[model samples]
Target: MSERPVSTTDLDSYIADLRQLQARRRPAEIPDHVVYPAGEITIPAHVSHWAAQRPATTALTFEGTAFTYPELDDLHRRLAGWMADQGISRGDRVAVYLGNSPEFVIAFLAILRLGAVHVPVNPMFAPAELTHELRDAEPGLVLTNRALASTVEEVQPRLDSPVPVLIVEDGWADAIAHEPFTGDDGDLDALAALNYTGGTTGLPKGCQHTQRHMLYTAASATTATQLSAEPGFTSLCYLPIFWIAGEDLGILLPFVLGGTSVLMARWDAATTLDAIEAFGVSVMTGTVENYLELMARPDIGERDLSSLVDPQAVSFVRKMTPQVRADWAAAAPSSGTLRESSYGMTETHTIDCVPYGFAADDEDLLAEPVFCGLPVPGTDIAVVEFGTQTPLPLGEVGEIIVRSPSVTDGYWRNPEATADQLVDGWIHTGDNGRIDEQGLLHYLGRRKEMIKVKGMSVFPAEIEVLLAQHPLVESVAVVPTDDPDSGQRPVAFVLPAEGATVTAEELVSWSRENMATYKVPLVKVIGALPMTATGKVRKHELAEDAAALNR
Candidate 1:
């Protein structure tokens, strides 16, 4: 098969362009220093800088509405003053249950400005799950959309601890009066946000990150990916602000860099395409599935997407099929625009990203699709094999360990789980990857997702990719189940392409022909595959459904 069309000048051109852009903008040849002063990391600081530099420039454009830098800055200051007057003390956690809107950004930044940690509650969570997080965080207050207040109220009376809840409604009277109140500047060392991630034992654990941690994350990400606006650059904010990748790059980084952000409350293929052409969006970050959906649209080819600097960003580790990579490069030429891939977990502040594509002579960079690039400035990374716990040689697949100023201190009060994951000051990134001779990183799989079949280790992601190539297969989710006889067996749940059909036997035969016998799933179900909001298949749910099907 012919190799996919890719820009040979990818790395060379990117470095040259970025270096030139930096040099012309900065008096010194050094990379532009993002000044994040000590003592307090507040939204007010970023907003103030942007307001002073580009007061009239649009800061955010959401659903046909726009807010300039000064407008957003004024709102932040006023909200902060009101919050301080209402006695929301520094370091207090405040839950926010709101959709993607102007108020969402205002509320989040306002909470940060008041030196309060914002607990971003998942809007999709059930009342029980929502209540549990709220109770655990024990936030002093909650800022919720008027529509979601009922859910909060329903869970309120049942809680052992109650918190004051305020409604965020446009044109409504402020819950905290506009009267000014003096307050202390936030201590940057203080906690900034508490994001919940999956626990090792299948429970939710909060990851507390400080201002410096978040700042470092955003700075490093922007630097590594070269996320910039270049005067009229526009970015599509499709992912929810709750996701670290979306919030850091889509929202926070734009403001810090004085860039225009176009927002969408939800993802709709046709609407997303229309918005891209209408708003002249230059960049967007989303999964390959999203790009596929947009491209499948009948009118997509006719749409004027030349304004896009990158068709979209792809996760190499999650969706790194040779076909997928080829499709992306063809759609957005590496020399014309870049779709950089990134590697990082929630704990490390979502740091580390590498520009995409490799040329004939650039064999060094092509060694890993999960090339998160070299650690940004203060970060460190090491690859160690699983059994011996010894650092592995470059090019050997192993666990990717990291230590950085941005790494979380520990999970919230979970000492046992913390001890198991963190070792010798390194956060054992539950992720398996390898470093190439040229220093690029490649992700293999997550430790937790490793499946054991007949005493052999198998990665579901590897199997899923092969299954996805089948003509009838629209998507696939794989998991391991105990077989009583064999230690475990691979089981797959598949979603067929619309209007197409495939039997379990035929699917199994196809998989057998494509993958190794051990890797082939013994149990196969043809049906819809459950997915998260961000388009990642919820493998745990599929596994449960698969078990029930066999039973």
Candidate 2:
């Protein structure tokens, strides 16, 4: 897979290709305050306010069940009492290992209602992955559905102290209906959650966030999306709530907007479109793949999608490029704008820079690769020199530094990692990017993921984004392999479009003509690219495959 393509010898011959061609930068302008209703600022506060004011309004709809705001609040309050009785209390960690369902939301808020730290574990985790989280979090209790209960049970005995597991079932209503939690609310500054984040490299690390952090994320995101309760704001939640991105879009955003969420356990283009048409879903947020899949469906244009507005898109396995936005607008005329969702990480509770309606205003902004629009209101984003931490000039690519209200307290129980990553108040995002003169941030890629070929730096994401433009390419992942001459060389694993008979040589030729000679990578055809549960490419897996070929 890592073998150099014969058609391209400019990499080895390398005479006049020191400078890599770069796309012109056109940054989007940051906005002032995003419009959001004042008052109720926290999740519990929102629940309480809505329950008292708009009790009959539906807050969540799952499968065939619907719960009004008051009913939803009441049920979680009862569950919180049950958790309290099970020895979960303020500051205690309670892990909710469940899929996307009403149960997940119920368990989540119930845990928070008790002032306990909510630890969301991905249900797709295997026994080993599950064990690592449980061990690190050391939760006082675990909540899961019947199907996932055994996975928790399997990992419980491995913990230093066995933790209690509660299966969220119908009987949960009976267990706590007689009693409701009357506990005091957690302090805004109190630790609220352990949002876990990781890659293909090592054990997942937990980012400690506070209720204040969560509240700011929820509120600012509401502003960013321009969500309003008037005339009703509704969204679809098919993405797993366990993920930071999912937690924000699926749960927090609606809570802040005082809107309704129509939940689906997972992604299915047909069901999502049906939900949008049936429920008048006004706003939608998901990966780029979701919108693409929707457009691919023949019935997309036929569906009654007049109510659906601009869908918030996250760039994960697939980037939200100019072409995608153009295609989406053509396929669904009602979609007002299609742009990258919030630019953040779990460390910032997932929203540091916000993108809303920017693409609609500036077509040039869409052309920038990995463009993360504007910092959150009241937050500071700085680009600094890699080693000295000296602030870099605008438009000069460097390390990104973000200090926001939504920034995490720190990594849980990992002082060494925390001290290294967090300085003063800013979180040093290991990502490489640059803020343009217009203030738009362009995330070049992960610093470690950059390939040093000959003497030039090549960003893998830029290569992948470029290759994906070809009509014959379905997907592509680029990984760096060691080279004797060049410090490292990019090896691309190409997934051709179905039934397309394009060969590696043809791809290499296309790359040589379309891209910089040094930037052109060795192309290898593959049936499928390895992916994580939340739709992230497993670059480590690809790198390993490339390493073996080199060996």
Candidate 3:
């Protein structure tokens, strides 16, 4: 549906008009928490609370500038008013296509403030990739930075209806400089966010999460992490905000607790260290590769990391080795509570299984197989038979199925896929796991093939689809190979066209131009791809071959 476009002058004029009339609710009356007091929770409740209770407190710090709680609230709500003035209301989708910046957070808050669904589009996506998600989400408005606006412009002509794109200039000061939106609170049961994740079929499916689902996740995370309002928590937001896990920690968890998320322009080990010392950064969540880089730094030991506390970090893809843990303990000894973070996916809102109280020496971290701790509040975990609902014995390895209040009802607009992954309110997470005798969940690995490159989700099918588009490429099978730094790297086995002379470097160069750099595969010119009897590409065999070739 087409939406009314709004201008800065229009928003100001509308606010002046509203000043003459009275409304049912005022912004000051809104509560501080939307997560707690369970039944009465909304997406923007926490922002209102923090803005009222601790207006001057630093809510978010980026580069060298900081936005206090009230400052952030004022900007977001006014932006919401501007959107509302455009008749963009509940159920309308708004795409946030910016990087990890304050603009991303403000736009996200504004969308939810208007009861609109938040669609966090990946900033790394190319035109082909961007078109797929925009087509599916059907955003009425697209919020992007100046540098990325061209990508949106490129994809505009290809969409069913061209979305109105707002390129942020000077922190959207003029765009949001109006009276605040003191409209009604968000409906907890209504759709709030659409987190897009790549599937086995090669398309990114949106995981439709309601406001209540977000509330439950925030509540579970609060209890699990022991977050409180007394002394506000502060963490780094170097992680990609588009990803569900990153969004939870960076935006959801921090705001829900009235804490500050010091945002970095990008990941730099020295800068992360500087932030830790500079901002008294309390918690840290990152990859094993990130930890290695920090530990590898000779000056890391010299850095004052006393403020980095209660760090039960989440190291993804490759497991965090004991040596790495020992190194961190030795280097940053002040981080006493270092251990595994939580277990979750986009559909379940990440934080499904939380290692809440697990310490460094606890069996939770040193388990034989990887441990995902216990299920969060109002969530149940069952290890079922592979591809079936039959409950397996506690020790038997099976597919981990989760039934949680926080679980998404289904994928957005895809009933067939919803039926395949979600059954009877139980999310069939295609992960290999088992319940130990002590009732702790131990994760084995992925039953389905979803490769992770430096903690970024990279589907083999998506890579293969992109590679197959090459003119010289007859057929391609993408599989994961061992990577010391990135955990796992995609290795493509390409069957070239007859008499075609295409170098491996040419295919790699082509892939770099098409997809995200992390998703780009190391091209290998092969005579044929291993196939099943039905002529399907045998990915597992190709994976083994890739490992052998790497060795």
Candidate 4:
């Protein structure tokens, strides 16, 4: 199987056909000036513009502490100045290893202001996981809080060279007292951030994004999600700031629109509800797990959630059902409707499809199990024959490919992987889907061996490699099993070493100790593994077996 050669004429026709589909499904016109030209403006420039125009407007609210636009801009500028004093310069990587706090936002802006690339590290990462990213990114400085300082220290020795660690709590107070940064704005094409995403074959790879990419994502997300562009437009942000979605909504969107974001250090149903009620949050985003947890809150019905307008969610953890949507609408009448569904990846910086403004009872949306709405403006999507890149006709299921200004430049330090994923300006998304006649994307499933647990990508190969290290394990096959609350959970079919005894509990426990919580699989011991004629484990059969176990 290989990609078929597509002629110039055929390609042009295919693109025109895609545009027609988009026109059919296009939502209302985006408000004027809501979406800025891509590659023309940087995020720091947005901040500066908003600060100059709406200096007194509240820009962020975290745990009762608020920062106005001017104050927030000044803090980031001062932090950028402090970072420069520490020898950081253009193109240097600076890792932000903090959770969803005000410090994370400050650090993010500071890095971008100084023309340095931001490296967002998951605060939940264990030492081994953190070490991999540090070694790969080789950041000049790591910014973390006191709580997670030990995690950074533990991984410091593993790096090829010693990197400086700046504790957020200890450094912020003094940094804010220094003179603000008066440096030149970073070039639009210069690298802005290195977002790490899990690979199908190995450890996570960093997606290299530039200022243009980030600005484009923020603009498209703002317009596509239908966020209010007015000042005082409040949003609840409990999502991790380290992730692309979190960065877009919690930091970029609010700044771009001169709005206020109420941040939570971590998600707790009670706390989230309280913040929503107290701040009159108008917009928010979350995964299925977060929504489920909020719905499960006993006092959910009594809360005043009338402030919510356009809440968005991804259904990777579980399919969004009519009942769930109804329940959500009932809980927040002002929300006017259930959360709009969208599709994106780290490679795209967050958003690709925007379903906002689509009727809740649209027949096409109801019929398609994975109906992610039309591509946002300045973005194009197509379904092509796998391997060959030949354009498939409308309604034909094939590999979903994307061409957008927001797509990552490529993977950092992995030219081979970059070549495989990015080709001729189109990102070869491993996802399989078809563009229906109505212009909506109907997701089939992944074309690769990957599992999404609680909206986080988990690869079987990564887990298999870790479990193989167990002394009593001889062979292992990891497959995704259906999960109601989480989209899918990993299940391990294990073959114990000859004459060795290992209980499922023991292996599960070992996995908990060695891997991230989301990567640990439900272990099932098997006497022998199903194999193909070529001597490879039959993962499809294992997936079926795992599904059967659920029944």
Candidate 5:
């Protein structure tokens, strides 16, 4: 790709051409109405609408317990009112620290209903990691289950102020007795949630999204993927609800379409298969790792998965091979030959490109590097030069930038970051990719040094800092190496302290104890790390070396 900056007129023309291509690929009519004419459509609005329209409809099912639309609405309303009684008002941030349970969904909707911002803390985060978010967000209250209340309490004293902690089980009775929230609709521009993403700076940054952004995400995803919200429309929720994609598919899409959502606390291949068969789940989305686990199950062949419709997978870590696709098709004969695939990030609330009615035999399209399909309706994407914002020509690798109604406003309380990333209404997604002649986007790799294990973003700087703390290690640099099943795994190059000795296995074991499973790096002992003349570690060189060593 040319480094020379393209003229503004030329760049605009290129963007226009890309949009035209996207228009050509768009469906004639999106199956559902994504855009709402109402001034400010919020999550609470969706819940209330569904509650009145389909009171008896099953809205959520979790571990043998089912909650109907009206029941869920009542719970959320009462919870919102209870939150108000606790002095939690609109614009205040409320952190939700819990696993994927009915309580997680209830708390999330309750926060939105109260017009408060929801801050989802990764349940896998260690106390220190959790503390960082608490200090940064300084939320008014943290809602957690009894199992995780200790973690929240541990981080409470570390915050700038003494924030209240609401244990879900203890609060449930009070919330049920509390009056339902009868507040007016929230302004579309009001902040809805603060999604924290790993930063290269070794800290987490919160992405501020508005009510309008949330609604648009749900609408665009539904329309682009042709997802149905009919009575039988059901989705498997195995992915973490803390993540953006998970929130989109698991909560927003189902609630908006008035479909049933089967909730799982975590990914378990066997349980997921059983749920799919039992509930007749028609929609599911997960990383390639998820599918591989299902395929590895001996009982997979016997399980009936015909209810699955257009199951999608993010093929970043491991490309879905022809054989795997064939096996999946055979296993779930009702879901045609091809399982859908797409590309997205947390910054953009939902996916950018969807297969938009792709057929199974379209191998030419699927062969592309995790072939990201065309842009969804009301979203525009461009491939621009890495450093400069100049648009690149088609078929050339460059930075991928996006402009969409659902794209986040900016990072919370981080104006410098906001200015650096959100430029001229376009989020400069530090992701590297190219647009083919057919208008499909192909993900080459990330321009940033972030490591993707499975579909989770793991920052190397965070891991390096932790590893460097070990007495056995003097220096360390983390790099990502391609993994057939995980998309990419982190490999750490460590130089032992002078006259000290440490084994790779020892460090790997230590990592498993100290960090989240996905963030743990595969240890590779090296005498010295490859570095440039300025003494900065050349991560690219180390990545190449790690790749070779892995092979």
Candidate 6:
């Protein structure tokens, strides 16, 4: 697998080609419309429909085991019964503390089948972090693997309503008896799941989602993947299923749409590409970091990836130099159309997606900083003046506010935070972006100081506060520096006590010990960060300074 290098000119030429393609026919002029059937029911029905109609079709490919629709359905039924037998009644919360295995899928559907909320906890979460969500959700039953079972056991002593941890494989005999004998009949008003935010700041909060919402969103997302009518479309499911947005759109949507997925334990670039070729995957979606690493792989170009398709998001596109954007796109294996750019948070149920090949006039400028494209159907996107809640003009940048059916209701229990985020039915998406005349959205920056490092969200304020607690440190400021591999990496600027000397590696190690690996800064130093009149760190200046340091 030899690498294929594309030039800046070649990149620009392709953008020009894409512009010509867009100018030839407008999306509005195409006269195509999506029509959904009336009386769309809840999620359990959708799953049941697929199970009945395509019982023999491949439902999931996980760990070399290809589960047929019938097998998948039976697993869900047995799991549902198991939940009931374990005293998990309808409307109860069931936390699935497992990885991307058959058990995760079965556990999720089973919880929904019994009309209970399915809270999928991140398997990568530390015990303290897992305990927080456990306390918040207060699930009656938790499904865990052998590896995570101990974590649950350790945290059980600390939680108020510590529930029974059922090891899926080891406790199969005990769990099967609890299989939900009831069919796909349940209340739609019941909660579907409580998706917690990836807490870089404090404890993750529960995002309340219902069965109807998940079903509808899954249908729309299914269409978005272009898998509605396309049979045998292979999807790559690597991200943790705990994140409701990715699980629904990336995994479940494709399944319900009659598509296949090549499951992995986690993201391994080499393994991912090999699987793409091995399973004949057509569509792959992940953060920008994932793509960059895959592209940089030693033999990326030689891989038989003729089946690769749409990319949901790309990070480097937003920060790419004009030449680099074109270069990157041209370099992307032309097997699948990188047709869209999605800009959304987990809270909005992953709303605000924009398709590529829409804006012709701004193609040159647009290609430089990745444009998020236009809002999806049945969505209203607005760039409003900060703090005033007033809509901005066409090209003026402001806080992005979205109103849509996909928008989550609110944060669970945290009424104060919920009140702050949800105001007047408009979700204040903390991203900064502007819309062009043709309604294409271009991402500017984030409203808060949260930095998206690799695909992980890292808030500098969280790290700075933690480091400030150190005895040797007087002041600290963390700023994001660009990296070709990892979209962004944090570099800490510290003002130590007078003449104290601390190496960057030592500071980095110190941060690693105190926080999550992603939360720690990669680079650390001894110096005071530039500040303004109000004593706030001059972040923009620090960014420029970091750029110079890199040079």
Best by TM-score: 4
Clashes of each: 1, 0, 1, 6, 2, 8
* Reference-based lDDT, each prediction: 0.66, 0.74, 0.78, 0.81, 0.80, 0.67
Q: Write the per-residue lDDT of candidate 4 for residues 1-551, one digit (tens) a residue.
A: 11435454666688887787677667656542336632256787777777888888788888889998888888989999999999999999999998888888888888998999999999888777788899999999999989889988887788999899899778778977779889976667898899998877778899999988887777777776666566667878887889888887788777767778899887787888898888888888777667878888888888888878777666765656777787777766666466555687899987888767665575434766677777877888888888756788888999988889989889999988888888777888899999877767877888888888887779998788778879999999999998876768999999999999999999999988667798889999999999999999888888888987655
1 or 6, greater by TM-score: 6
Q: Which stretches of candidate 5 lie over 4 Å from their true place?
A: 1-8, 27-40, 292-306, 364-366, 467-475, 482-487, 494-514, 522-530, 541-551
Candidate 6: what lDDT? Answer: 0.67
Say what the RMSD of model 6 is.
Answer: 9.0
Instruction: Spell out the clash pairs found in candidate 4.
Output: 2-388, 3-387, 3-388, 4-388, 317-486, 317-487
Which residue pairs in candidate 1 have backbone atoms (N, alpha carbon, C) closer than 3 angstroms, thus clashing? 39-188
Error of 6 at 195 (Å): 1.2
Candidate numbers, best TM-score first, in rank order: 4, 5, 3, 6, 2, 1
Model 5, residue pairs in steric clash: 317-486, 317-487
Candidate 6 backbone collisions, by pair: 1-299, 80-180, 81-178, 81-179, 81-180, 82-178, 82-179, 354-374
TM-score of each: 0.72, 0.76, 0.88, 0.91, 0.89, 0.79
Worst 10 residues of 6 by lDDT: 29-38
Per residue, candidate 3 scores C-alpha lDDT tens digits across 106-132 of: 888888878899999999988778888
lDDT of 5 by residue, 381-446 (tens): 888887677888888899998889888889989888887788767788888899888777888787
Best of the candidates, lDDT:
4
User: What ranking emerges by lDDT with the best candidate at the front?
Assistant: 4, 5, 3, 2, 6, 1
Tens-digit lDDT track of model 2 for 1-551: 11211222432221112111111221223234544453635576677777777777788899979998898888888888888887888899999888898878887788777888999987766565677789999999887878878777776777899888777674565645748788764456778899887532345679998877877787766665555667377878877788777787778777767778898898888899889988888877777778899999998888788787758776554656778888988999876677777677779887877656467645535546777766666566777777435666667888887778888778898877777677767787888998776666778877656676643446676678667778999988989898765557889999999999788889988887556577788888999988999998898889887776555
Task: Specify the poorest-scoring 10-residue window by lDDT in model 2.
Answer: 14-23
Error of 4 at 340 (Å): 3.0
lDDT of 4 at 445: 86
lDDT of 1 by residue, 275-391 (tens): 877877767876656766665677765777777765545642234355554655565343134344466777887755343333223332354555555555455666776632456
Stretches > 4 Å off in candidate 1: 1-41, 170-172, 175-177, 180-185, 228-230, 315-340, 356-372, 385-389, 450-551
Can you give the lDDT of residue 415 in candidate 1? Answer: 75
Please tell me which model should have the higher lDDT, number 3 or number 6.
3
TM-score of 2: 0.76
